[model samples]
Target: MSHSHSPVSAPATNGHDLAARIAELLTQIDTVKAEYATLDKRANEVAGQLAQRFPVYDELYMSAATEYNRAQADLARTKQADTEPDIPLDDAEKASTPNQAVRSELSGSTHNAPISVNKLYRRIAQLAHPDKTDDSNKHTLFLEAKEAKKQGVLSELIRILALLTGDETRPEQLSQHQGQDALAEKLSRINVLRKELTLYRSQLMQLRNSPMARIVDLISTNTTLSITKAETLYKMTILQRVKELETNTSGIRQDIAFQSNMNKT
Candidate 1:
């Protein structure tokens, strides 16, 4: 009774067991945290893929929509133009007017390549000659041809006109053939060609002033803008040709002045 039975060692054993249980629980918690981190990373990757795919899908849809709208607008415009009433042809007026020649040349050019300018003028004169019978169709054709010849058909129209008129001269050989009769014919054709050239110049100016031309300029100036090399080359060629023509004309003028002064002396 005196030495109270030494306290049983059970409490110590129980404390050791409790500490072991806590360490096991902490290890399990760490494992769960690692698994959660993995899950979070996978979820983020899936979200990024969805975001990237949706924008591209939407852009494709928008592009398709724009194309469809453009097609619809073009269709509607074509239909409207088709439904309009046509103007009746005036037989006598058309026969008397200069436009008849133009119409004929336009039709002929559609069927064949452009005729030479000298030839075109000759053919027109033949058709319009007073000795020819007064055929309304022929008259209209002659006038149109004359008008077209005048506009700048000299190079191509002349060839066609010369062929029709039974003339053998080509544009390049014009200066060599200086006989009075040849000069007269050449002078007449030159006048017409000048007029046509003026109209073409006007058309070129109109194109230069167009919004499309502005866009082309923008594309040329901006490094990031998309444009084909061929288009740029074509524009350059056109400009070069214009410059060449101006130089040639200036030389011709100087020659004419020199010839005139020599003749006067």
Candidate 2:
């Protein structure tokens, strides 16, 4: 009996189709990476500007505001105490006031403390006087320093001096470290962007394995599928993914604007 002839194989064309699709995807990925870099840079710029405008606000805004509020409350309390009649406390009440003698001694001795605390207070005032600087937080620090000196709390004055170190940088000196604040801000934003990039990369991988991407593979492996049909489907999938990336990009821009506005307010 005669041997059966081997089936004739059709021409292989999948290599070119797959190569083209991969190239297209790579191009899109590169574009997205470039855009992400630009966004990261912009975030840094915004942060830097904010840092310059409000150098101490980021670190001490709430604390300074709280201190100011507390001072106001103390003033109100003092005024109320002055308006009330100074009735002598009964023996029972006097016995309950545990620190009355100690407080009396401390108050009496405040005027007799050494001059070192006053010197330290003067040094802090020279460096952190609110009127000497443009920073509003410095005003709060100045007021706190004054109160600490008035109370003769050497430890409190020292603490205030330590905190003033960050505010001691003159505007001219600050110019030397341009973008440092922005760089700090950029780091936080970059972290967020990295997460988004990972998600997008995952999406890209999923898209690569999608039926449309497989169609291109099919065109390469199977002779029945046409190159034109496979390319068209691949492009459609890519376009869809690109649109999604664009939407994500738009949202990111909005977020940046919102953050910038919040800093302004």
Candidate 3:
């Protein structure tokens, strides 16, 4: 028997090769972001259609979803998976209550959070200002800085500042970076794009697995069905969901009641 080993690929060492790779990564990241946006839009459109067809289910579904989210958070807490699910709890919170989500987030993060997200954001903005920086990615960095500021994500602003200046601890060291090597900048840019690609792809996966995505998938998958047949099928599906929700909610309540009674005994 012959033993074989997998070949290892070498990293790009040439300046031109690194620059080309960075350009490619940027394109790929943009494509993934665009795809996620399109999918989200389609799901929202499908949800609106469902609402029009069965207005009554809308209230029931919202209530059921809220209860379901609460239960999930509690379960995750019990299991120590996270404060909620590890990946998308923030997205869920924002979707349900945008204003309250921000307040709650700030409240929870106050311990280690910066004194003021706005002030730190201003510092980052000044450091990465488009007019004061290289033209290649300054505008994009400025936009990301704004978003990080809005989201109260000080760490992200710090990371952006670090990438901008190629120095993690010295955010105001832009002067030293003015004459930085072009290859190093390209490498830093690729690192940023790689992170963005991962984030966008993760979001796409989450969206694909959401309940709203299921509705859009059903519509797309069964488009050949006669309109009346499709309508009937959808109605049945919505009815089943409402029934399941009622059953599950009632079951949870019964479990709690039983537990309380046992505790009293």
Candidate 4:
């Protein structure tokens, strides 16, 4: 069995301490998820308020935008279809294109994950013993465990072992093999959480930079600004965009109608 433990800084840190660290990390990740949700809700609320003030126009503007996008896509597709027959790929281009390139790659050797050893993997090996796989799923679980161990991913092994053995194994129960594998699993989870946090923050920043969010911030920034005044300010800003979309949508519909007539002729 491959040991798939991620390295926890102190190789000797007891399983109990590692579990505590894992708890702290999960709590922090959940907090970040909550923070992102709050800001997303705020941005949506601002949009809703604008829609409420301009109910009819709001619907028209959205409908028009969708129609405009669809027409533009259709136009592009039509142009491509009309011109594609005149241009044939050369020998080099044909070899590099999907039909040839993808087939060539598919005929090569399959890449495999690296393998290491761990106690949890040992436990998985025992539980998923080939001789005792009458449960049908046991063999599948064994393969998954083997793969996880090879990948040095103890967390996946832990999950599979729990399913095979029907035991709710906690982080502490996995303290075997000198706390190596479990510690690695904790670090893996932490690294994943850190990446998730970065992604969430980036999304939040994008929302903040959007026109609707900026308008909301601007109206709310003045502590003395009256509720009526703020409402008016939001409506005034969106009204211009709504008019622009209306014009664009009209133009797109006209173009689409002209194209349809030309196609028939």
Candidate 5:
């Protein structure tokens, strides 16, 4: 009996080709990841410098914004409560207290669902599980995945999964055109990375155009203004801007209330 050897060799050849395609895609993904990390680090460093140079301005701005938001939320909640029917209270709580209304506002604001750290941990582990691979870096990948999950860094976990799995939408039954499909998926991912890179570049440009950043740039180029003087100027300018914003916010609030009263009437 003569047995054909072509059928046995074809599957092995296809497997090798598939592995090579996956490896190439992984390399490309790694390159994109490195570039993104660099951009993100630079953006953060620039932001940190701005914050450090003007700590008081940053703090005051944050506090004012927070207070404005909270006040607006409270006003809206009060208006909503006014439209609702009053419920009868128990004999012990016959008197309506200010604290009762405050508690209701707090309750409404505190209903967010809890994050499941364990679920994220499991997902990262499943993707980079060392038991599935004998590569030297498998152990390192597993450790990093575990730490990212522990710290609730979902983005890191997602990046790791993308590197390991090539494509999240990989079909269960890879057809004869598997290599073409893999290439297409990898190119799609690269497109996403390019878009993200553009966004980061735009953010960097915005930061560079900020008042504090412009002052820093001027000092760098002109060499006439000292760092201390430049920072002082930036602080003064930013404070004035903050005051203007606060005034505008207050005016808008008044206008909203007037319009609301008119609608009610």
Candidate 6:
């Protein structure tokens, strides 16, 4: 009796072919990077021409330059991934306190709030800073909130501070914290994207070493035909592993959303 083999199972049969496929993918990645770099260079040249033709087009030129740099960075990242397939992404660090977030806002302002860090610390402490809070729960929340702001949980930190300081009734007053919160959210999204990219790189490596290569080895070794069924089972195993990566990416996205919502508070 003869059994049919799946197309996906074919790749699981041999080492040489598996390695060749991986090498092909790496080549493709390199080709894409080269193409992107060429396009980016052309974009910058165009942007320069625009700037020369009309000084008022400075904003347009700047925007074009920004896009070109973004492309360049993306291509650089792809090249790095091809060179080092196993690089892992680091998680974003958590924020410190609402005061810290406000300080960041202050630093960005043309009119700096003369609120000295130490003075601000003392004044804020009088209201809701952990040292001033007598209730244990409020104190704990205050400390956590402060640390979150310091680490960069700007929105959550600010909201907590506002609630503790009797500013919860005035949501508009919390606008300063909004900018920081937005920045934190962006950083969190960046971290998730990096991790997703890393997972894809790892998946590429796994596909290169899949069970299809092992089945091929068995065939080359003149193994009995009965073991072909076993090879198909091995292909299922690799598919399951890839599924695990997909699940992980989903979880990371959920975490990013949760973090964003937490900041809005």
**Best by TM-score, which number?**
3
Clashes of each: 29, 1, 0, 7, 0, 22
The TM-score values for the models, in the order shown, are 0.25, 0.22, 0.47, 0.41, 0.39, 0.23
lDDT (10s digit) by residue, model 5, range 136-246: 565576687678766866445555555566644323223335655554455444434443344344444444454545454445564555656666665666577568657
Ranking by TM-score: 3, 4, 5, 1, 6, 2
- Tell me the tens digit of each residue's lDDT in model 3 across 1-265: 9966645554436578878898898798778767766776665566566666776756556666567556545443443332222222333322253222221221222122213455555556666666456765766877887888778775576567666676542323432564446655555566656665665566567666655555566577766564445456555655666577567767756665555565566
The better-scoring model by TM-score among 5 and 6 is: 5
Please list the C-alpha lDDT of all candidates, in the order they appear.
Answer: 0.41, 0.45, 0.55, 0.53, 0.48, 0.40
Tens-digit lDDT track for model 4 on 135-223? 66787888887788778774476567666666433345444633657675665455444544554455556555555555557556766
Roughly what TM-score does model 4 have, to 2 decimal places?
A: 0.41
Q: How many pairs in model 1 have backbone atoms within 3 A of each other, for residues 3 or more apart or on separate chains, i.e. clashes?
A: 29
**List of clashing residue pairs for candidate 3:** none
Candidate 6 lDDT, tens digit per residue, 82-194?
Answer: 44232212111111222222112211211122112233233344566444556775666566655664565433444454556664423333335544443444433333333
Indicate the worst ten consecutive residues by lDDT in candidate 3: 102-111
For model 2, the local distance difference test gives 0.45
Q: Model 3: runs farther than 4 Å from truth?
A: 1-11, 65-91, 94-147, 151-180, 209-211, 221-265
> In lDDT terms, which candidate is top?
3
Residue 262: error of model 3 in Å?
21
Q: Can you list the residue pairs that collide in candidate 4?
A: 2-116, 2-117, 3-116, 3-117, 3-118, 4-152, 6-184
Q: What's the lDDT of the predicted structure labeled candidate 1? A: 0.41
